[model samples]
Structure formats: C-alpha cells, structure tokens
Target: MMGGARVRQEEPSVQKEANSWVFARSFRSEEEAVRLANDTPYGLANAVYSVDAARLARVASQLKSGIVWENCSQVLFPSTPFGGKKGKASGFGFEQGLAGLKEFLAEKTVVGTSRPSYNWQIYKKA
Candidate 1:
C-alpha cells in the first residue's frame, strides 16, 4: 500500500518517469492492461501480481517494459543489472551493475546451428 497514485498516464506528472506515480486503474481483463501499458514510449519497469504463475509469465513476456517484476516490486540487485529497453525514459543504455560494465565492452555473436548436424528424418514421427 503506497500513497496517492495518479489515475491517468497522460497526466503531466505521470508523463515523466517520476518513479513514484502509479497508473491507478481497473481493467475488465488482463489483455486490456497489457494493451494500455504497451501503448507508451517509456519502457522502464512494470509489475505483475497474480497467483497464477503461467498468467504472470504470459503478461511479463507481453510487456515491452525493460523490467517486469512478478509477484514483487522494486527488488533490485547489483548482479542482476538494471536498465531500460526503449526511448530516453530509461537513459537509453545506462545500465547499473555488471551489465553496465559489459555495455562498454565489445562483444559478438557466432551462430553454429544454421544447419542441423543430425538427420531430421530419424527424429521425425511417421
């Protein structure tokens, strides 16, 4: 239970990332919640509270925010790293923790599974 939370996201107070404002609203369904949440330029952090683990995973995956907490809120760890995904709302690529150090380092990806090594026909069901 926190203090007063703004009801609308469009409010000048909420438009900026205040880190305290909450979009206090009730949705008829979960889809509506996800829809309304994704329709924004800011992708900082989001929290999903549900007893159903599957539902939590589904909603977390659908959310475009940089961080999605399930059954928890504001739980941060230096090892886990904290950062935003899109837009200037999250400082673009300002990460905290090991990830922050990695961001400055160079990295590359090498794909070795372009072609299957084993025969697919063997594993295929008749």
Candidate 2:
C-alpha cells in the first residue's frame, strides 16, 4: 500500500520512544526497504525476516540500527550489547556485552561473544 511512502509516520511505532508496535509495509525491493528503515532517526534495533542468509546479511549490514536481528526480534542476551545509535534515540553507551564492560572498567575489556551462543537454525526455514 505504501508507494514511495513518506518518511514521516504517525503510527505509534515511530512516535513513541520505546514500543513493541510492529510496523509492516510493502516495498518493491530490498533497496526500498532499507531506505524506508534508515529514514528514521532512531537506530536502536531492527529485524530482518528472510530465508536467504546472503540477503539477510546484506540487509542487516545496511540497517543503521545499533542492533540488527536476523529473522529475530527482541532477542536479548547478557553477552550482547543492548542499546541504540543516533541523535535522541541513543544514550552514552551500551548496557551489556563488551560495551558494558568497557563502561565500568578503564584498563581493557575482554569478552567472548565472537561466536553467538544461539543457534542460527532457529531463524532458518525448516
């Protein structure tokens, strides 16, 4: 229904600071989708639902959000940094993971999350 839609959305998802409101819209291609997503100043977190891993990686890379979930949303972990990026949408630093460690300490930060703890297959098509 959205044809070269306006970046400004009146919906609660765009209006409210923290919300679970899921925004759904139609797009002609991935490029359009990325454009629509990055249009927002809030770069907190976003999810990409795709069967193609390559496409997921590509789209996730383009998203300006601080956290990008592949085929998953709101998946929290102690080893992962939970925060956002941008003007008003972001804060000083992340609250978890290596970022959090860096916040409390001064010398050096060491955390092992290079390999995600969760299974990638969970998001994949069975």
Candidate 3:
C-alpha cells in the first residue's frame, strides 16, 4: 500500500523466504512505481510496462533493481549488463557484455609495447 498504509494477506510459505514482494493493480505514475521499487531493501529485479519511451527510460534509471524489463518481463540479449544492487541475489556477473566476458578472462594492459620502450622508461622515472 502507498503512504504507509497496511493490508493483510495470506502469503505462501515460499514467499516468507523472500525478502518482500508487492503486487499492485496499477500505479498512479511511473515515477511512483519506480520509487516504490527502489525503496525496497532488495534490488533483485523489476518489471515495467509503458508506452512512452521517455517515461520508460526515466523509470528504468530510477529502479534500484539489478535487471529491469520495459514492456516485457525478461532479459532477451546476452550482451546487456545485468547485476543486482543492494546485495540482492543475482544469477551471475555481467552476462554477455564486454565486462561480463572479461570477468573470467585475464586482460593485459600494455602501455609501452606499441610505442618506443625508451619513452615509457623515461616516463617511469617521472
């Protein structure tokens, strides 16, 4: 409920294990929904349905959830960055993006190989 209102409902045993869950028929505005989603202690995931692209983007940014779906309820691509915030459980690190690919792999940052080695040595002294 909004504005600190409380309601009573029978929840399943599995739900008790969850941190919290909210089911609302509709939100007055996307901003309100995003605020409610972000106010939770958990940042697991969020689902949003909106026809306006601008509103969707604003809501997406405001959500503290690790993954947000706009007009859909799933992550479709493997190249998108996905992770949970506020210590919510996540499936894995950046899944299919460059960041995700580099998680398990080692990347070397070589600074001087392409340039003159003497130039790097000179800069190292400074």
Against the reference, the lDDT scores of all candidates come to 0.74, 0.75, 0.60
lDDT of 3: 0.60
Off by over 4 Å in 2: 1-16, 86-88, 105-126
Q: How do the candidates rank by TM-score, highest first?
A: 1, 2, 3
The superposed Cα distance between candidate 2 and the true structure at residue 10, in angstroms, equals 6.8
lDDT of 2 by residue, 21-102 (tens): 5666767899988987777657788888999999999999998877999988889999988888746466666789998787
Q: Identify the leading candidate in terms of TM-score.
A: 1
**Per-model RMSD to reference:** 8.7, 16.1, 5.8
Number of the top-ranking candidate, with lDDT as the measure: 2
RMSD of 1: 8.7
User: Of 1 and 2, which scores higher on lDDT?
Assistant: 2
Question: Residue-pair clashes per candidate, as listed?
Answer: 0, 0, 0
Residue-level lDDT of model 1, residues 3-93, one tens digit each, is 2333565756545666677655666789988986776667888899999999999999999877899999899886676778755366656
Ranking by lDDT: 2, 1, 3
